[model samples]
Target: MITSKLMRPLTTGGVLASTVLFASGCKSMIVFDPKGPIGEQQRDLIYFTMLLCLIILVPVLLIAAWIVWRYRDRKNNRAPYQPVWSHSTKLEIVWWGIPIVIIVVLAVVTARYTYALDPAKPIESDKKPVTIQVTSLDWKWLFQYPEQGIATVNYLAIPERTPIKFELTSDGPMNGFWVPQLGGMIYTMSGMATTMYLQADEPGNYMGTGANFTGRDFAKMGFTAKALPQKDFDRWVADAKASGNALTEEGYQTLAKPGTTDRMTFASIPSGLFERIVHDYSMSRGAPPGYTLRAVTLSEEKKAEHTAHPKNGQLPPGNGAQKDAPDAQSLGQPDHRSGHMHLIHGK
Candidate 1:
């Protein structure tokens, strides 16, 4: 009857859009509510890749609702019409062998959780990780704490069940660093140096952010992690090392320039100020003063005088945007294994 009155307003508009997405609650989905052990091993590898994509989406939605209710548009609808019904080799080997065995069991469960969530490895813990550092300025987020020498800025605290190493870099440009309950999102570039590790197993506060977008005070960067409880993170690192506020190196180059402030605290940081902000972006006179660094390349005779000889060299057209320097410099290298995404030059 006109397809049950057009599926009764498309099944009541998909049950009022799933009751307005279940009344929008999920406690701000802190990445499926994780709280540590690397966000519960990345939420159990996102619930085993959504239970292997609902085993190919519940058998292709119950065989597309039993081939639309056994071939509808009926009046004496005796189903099996077949009308030169194309080939089948057992339904094309059961739909291409069940998506190649669900893509080889999702590439062996994403290469065994990308080496078990390797945001720079180290998170075994009977407690002894802590480090910190970070940086990502121009919008903000400093952190430091080199074994509690202390430093803060947008703020982070750490400790609950221990194991946080971090390190990251960037006085600007590259960004990322997230903390959706305590795991993924790493990045933060500028003259390299990255590494993550994380942990948390309870205690609270969370929030952190800056998953990229660098411009207009990229929504004021954000930061606040907290965690606490190793004697409340050693009494909040002894009240941030007795906040006699120091920071130096001219106050971390005026808190790495470009704006946004509040939530500061120091009490000494500036010995190797995050190893000179990762060696001031491989300085040969580059990324330091007001460090912005989005592209970084130069040299190799200015990359063979900005290459692109197209018309005769051909292939130099569309997909541009790659001036280079996006990954590998592992500052003072000790194999900062964010699985090295290539580009390692900087002498």
Candidate 2:
């Protein structure tokens, strides 16, 4: 049937459309942009590692294929059956020494670059590195500039090609901080700090997001990282500081609640905002665990009377006749006149 013949092409067309749509939806697939020295070093490291791996892999793979085709049983008509011969010093040395050399080379190269790119290190620049404190909350990101006294949610803007250092922490669960074109992803946890460096070489807007899995709105937990000229960035900051209401301690307490979606910016940032977020005082209160000891002592204090005698009334406070020696008479027969009883009473 013509319908049946058309179905195959139609199905293929649908599959192709879906694949293109999926890839298009994820547009920020670009890895590293060599804006700053740090990003350049990271890109270099990746390229070098890949190139070195291919060097050893390509030769080994080609040699394997050549041996299989040249020594096939069909070409020889009769393959020799011989006793095992294991000892080959040259081949064994080549295989073992090659891998060892590769590992040593990789280790030395990676270690040197890793220390150089340490976030705490001071990179040489004509101007000072801008400081930004980032806090990850449940389903939202808070960016605060202690120096500028401004705050923004889900958006960060800095001068292009200027070194920017981020001191990152979290108020809620853990999250990953990533700006794909700028650099790699790092983690943020409550009460702990992590740092990352990035600079936009090209003056443009880049997308950044949390690479870690969070709750419902995790997919939308992203923002725009804008790189602008110094003058333009300053103007933007000034305009933001003048437009909206000042964010105070009370304002932050209200915003600290979970489930903030998309982006919001605060015109005025509260003083000591970062410190308060780190040492959260608004946690729910409860009786300390050491209260159990107090409970036991109070229970003992509340008891009014304690009985000592089982056959009759409570015994007196002291022993009227103390026995200096063990009594042999009570071993065989019941002693009804035992006067060595004591009573404890709490009132």
Candidate 3:
């Protein structure tokens, strides 16, 4: 070994190694081997925005460096203190106007791609888009294909290049939906709905998980998005339907329970289950039984009549009805009735 007095070589080698290791850990720095159109757009958006940002950033950095170097203090530390010259109309215009233009360009580009990737818009190809209703539960995803009449947990299968429309909502409030390679994240809240559209270009399994932290096992709230050939996807659906365990309303109540590490499957789904889930029927059903009774508003005149004459329509104060004079006294007590008595009492 060559004799080295200074640790400069070893220190420099260690620094270089650390830099390489850290850079390797960044997912973006890795090459894009996209398996979907959504993935391609995501990667392109990253690079395009990065380049646009650098156009302004790099020049500002260079000017800062040049100014620092040129005005650096020397033994002759004479420098002009021109505090009043700090506000330059031209410089201000350049800074503000350039950023505005950049933002406009970015916004236009983003909107174009976003609409192109809209899930509600069906592709014009021969392939019909897969419709999946996704319900986010405490720690799992429930995917129901109404057309296929089948349901699955922790797995979803779609054909490559075929668009998918996911109608998403939560079993409860503690969840968010995301598939990093597919599209942006959306919230999944009870009594509310959100949608996401995506199309994969290759046949493979991609990992996706809930991006929001809910509770324990949030890390495990993941599902496998499988892009299969059309034939394979059809087969999967057929198999699911043939499995025989139908997901009924009662079955869904069990599936929607809280706590974690739960999973369930359905050979087929009961008719109208998907519609019910999407239309917030569960929330409606969960309402108190008597709450369903309509409360008809009484007009001021009607209210006055009801107050003056009081009967079955009026609010009950003491109890039901007094049959006779002695019953009105109730063997001893005077019923406090003036307001409601006329309505309840006949004639």
Candidate 4:
């Protein structure tokens, strides 16, 4: 009667706990519901690690329960009592050897997966990968499709079953780009470019967001990644072109300003826009200047002379260097070497 009473509450508690866990498991988790090859690989790694851990966890738990039940302070119990026992060579070896073997296996699997799933590594696909330039803005994401000659803000569209090569940078503070169902996160830093490759096996809309804490609006820094069939993707590009929105230099300047913005699309974009953005950010550390491109082929002698004596700590100028060139700093323009100048009022 006493044992039955004690077991009743434990049985009820176990059932309650199982019910709660079952209910929680019904919810969909993106990591488990992967839609792409990269995500599947990551999910497999997670499951593999969990199963390996359970190999030790289950045996230890079972042994602990058996010891508690068989050695409990019961009137008729006859379990062995080794109060003075120091150690057992077999037990020690079993415990240590099992864990070491598990570790070795895990390490090998982890290393293999790490190399196979490197973000920068290209996906194995016969189709040519689509290159997308990603720029993390103050509170939004800008994607430029150079091949398609179009751009979109806070929305990325790609063709299903095709590899995507993402070249990422940031115009605002440092941020992380992540598409949970597609692949892992990659950092986007200003003045430096990073690359990641991802793909979707089927048509669907996945949520992409900035995984790093950026600013006040970081929570809202999200975008939609839509994967569609080839025909649909081409139609999207055509529709974007018909929208008549052009991402011009002046327009981008305004759009690049710090603030949140709704989804936007451009039908056309200036050629070499992505390169210019990267170059401008790298060179000026501010907005891109309307500087004229003047290529000068310098002879070896001229190069040596320029290297020996840099003009105003600047690289040797080509023939186009004016004798009385205006000082960019004095003119309140961005200094090529010193970066942008911030003017203080009433100083």
Best by lDDT: 4
lDDT of 1 by residue, 1-347 (tens): 99999999999999999988875865568798888888878888888988988899999999999999976787876677568857769989988999899889989988999898888889887768878888888988988888778888897888788888888888879989899888899888987898988888888898989998999988888878988788877877788678787878887787788988889888777788788777867774463343222223333223333353424332233334234322233322343444322222454
Q: Which model is ahead, 3 or 4, in terms of lDDT?
A: 4
Model 2 scores a TM of 0.71
lDDT tens readout by residue for model 2, 96-132: 9998999899999999998987776766778788989
Specify the highest-TM-score model's number.
4
lDDT of each: 0.77, 0.74, 0.70, 0.85
Model 4 TM-score (2 dp) = 0.75
Over 4 Å off in model 2, which ranges?
Answer: 1-29, 73-86, 281-347
Q: By lDDT, is 1 or 3 better?
A: 1
Per-residue lDDT for 1-347 in model 3, tens only? 35463577888899999999886776563235456666677778878888899989999999999999887778776777766646689988998999999999999998988787665555556667788888888778888888877888877788888988888887765577766666556777766667777778778877778888888778888888888888888887788777788878887888778766445568878786656665664456343235323221223224445545677385433332221122222222333552222212111
Query: How displaced is residue 244 in candidate 1, in Å?
Result: 21
Model 4: lDDT equals 0.85
Which wins on TM-score, candidate 2 or candidate 3? Answer: 2
- Residue 189 displacement (Å), model 2: 0.9
Can you give the TM-score per candidate against the true fold?
0.33, 0.71, 0.69, 0.75
What does candidate 4's lDDT look like per residue over 118-165, in tens digits?
999999999999999999988889999999999999999999999999
Instruction: Kindly report which residue stretches of model 4 are placed more than 4 angstroms away from their true locations once superposed.
Output: 1-27, 72-82, 286-347
- Candidate 1 Cα deviation (angstroms), residue 228: 8.6
Ranking by lDDT: 4, 1, 2, 3
